[model samples]
Target: MKLIKTEDAVGHVLCHDMTQIIKGVTKDAIFRKGHVVTEADIPVLLSIGKDHLYVWEKEEGMIHENDGAEILCSICKGDHIERGNVKEGKIDLFAECDGLFKVNIELLNKINYLGEMMIATRNGNFPVKRGDKLAGTRIIPLIIEEEKMENAKAIVGDEKILEVKPFIHKKVGIVTTGNEVFYGRIEDQFTPVILNKLKEYSTELVEHVILNDDHEKITEAIVNLINKGADFVICTGGMSVDPDDKTPLAIKNTGAEIITYGAPVLPGAMFLLSYFNGDIPVVGLPGCVMYSKRTIFDLMLPRLMAGERITYEEISKLGHGGLCLSCDICTFPNCGFGKGM
Candidate 1:
């Protein structure tokens, strides 16, 4: 290889892969193939302080090692991820598995700033090997900071985190207790509505009981359902402050610890959540729950199926964003009202 002057090297692009420049100029002032350069060449190339340096090459799907998708997948678990076009430090992800997993949002930020990103799935806390299938990420776009990716790496070391909850076939018992619905006054629409929602998840109605607004009878029905091994018990109607409303008292009589007798949410503020000694979850649903699009039932049912333990503090925090207006379009799926679950 021959040496060339810095001026001669100005307009010439790399003809071949170049590495380890020897840094000298020949009297002929022309660089030949394989002629190396040194620190003196740094002044001419104008490349410095970048987290990444690369030779410009045109190739399809060549992503940076610090890409956001790769970083997110490394921390998140599951397979079947869809890739999206890279742009401005953000990537979309969708989970194919129906389970519970934690996301390290802080690590996502670092990949965003690193100029390129890749998405991968959590391979039990160690670095994921090449060609491992990642969870589908195309549906949910995740954004992160470019510099925070390194910090995300350090925190992800060898921790066997629970990525998703195993699917549990839930057996639910529905108790429709209301004077209006029990008699020939009105049709029992609440039962059908609750059944339709439960059908969306993996569940079966183990028992369905229609009782009047009598606390003793309602309590007996609940106890009977528990004895039948019902995982969840839902009591519909009679959740108001009216004298005839006795669902709350009935649930309390079953020796269940009432988590919250009322929630901050609208259209379902009269909702109640309680847990019996066997850890069976019992929900006291209000009348509006039947007709309202957004209610406490809508918020809690998903978490219940996901096997999350409902706490009073978490239910209390729902007040701020839980109010769902009956919009004409009914955009419940996109809305974040109960997404905290």
Candidate 2:
């Protein structure tokens, strides 16, 4: 590329998009890249403070900004991810279906650390609806060495840098354990919360049972649901360490592999997760999930529905952004309640 005075650039092509900003009115590119500058266009270009401009001049080893952005988009494009057109040396990506979005943070960091380009996205490991914006790729300059983009591709190797796994339909069962709720002293409010959350996903409530804090009964209920072809089972209440809290013991008696009994997150420290026969998930939700607008359950539900296994290592990382601010107007899933750096 070469810089020339705007007046003598009548026949030259613009190397980059020229943006004209008018506060909230508009902030769009008035002169797009590769547009041949005409005599009539000089005055308007000058009005936007374009005294001089860099005109496109093809070089053998260098690539244009838009081309670099295309490479970045290619790295991020995966199943259920849609790519947008290059605009102002950037490309935006969107979700093609409702699913859990994931980022290959290791490769992403290596590419970012190489400099000259960037891929910005919403927090991963969360639910994203169809047409939701997933990521945007931007090149820092109007031109860069083609080798740099090639290096990024090499770093990413055979795998895409990001992914969106569509949520799988799940057959669910609920075990509501608590003496008060079982005896009808208090309403079964916890079941309503679970049901309401279920409305967000593709889930069928195949089984539901209300019982006192009995380990044997809770264990029997969980196994029965699994035998009935439940994709997963949720046990609510009786998760604390109190003497009467037998839910944890019941889950153990069922012989399900317990991934973790507690998480390092607020409002969800007593949560438990296990898998029966190595596949069907069984979870014990703390009482906080019944009342809190967002908790560990909300953070992990999308992944669970998508059939992603949650390891103890993954749960241990939630401490960074697990504290919900409980804002007056809570915009959950959009907020950083479970997105750790």
Find the candidate with the highest TM-score and give its number. Answer: 2
What is candidate 2's lDDT per residue for 55-92, written digit by digit as tens?
Answer: 98768988877778899899878898998888767999
**Residue 75, model 1: Cα distance from true site in angstroms:** 1.8
lDDT of 1 by residue, 193-227 (tens): 89888876789888999999999999999999989
lDDT for residue 239 in candidate 2, whole number 0-100: 96
Candidate achieving the largest lDDT = 2
lDDT of 2 at 201: 94
Give stretches of model 1 more than 4 Å off. 1-72, 78-92, 99-150, 156-167, 339-341
* Whole-model lDDT, model 2: 0.90
Alpha-carbon error at 152 in model 1, in Å? 1.8
lDDT of 1 at 255: 96
Over all chains combined, what TM-score does candidate 1 have? 0.65
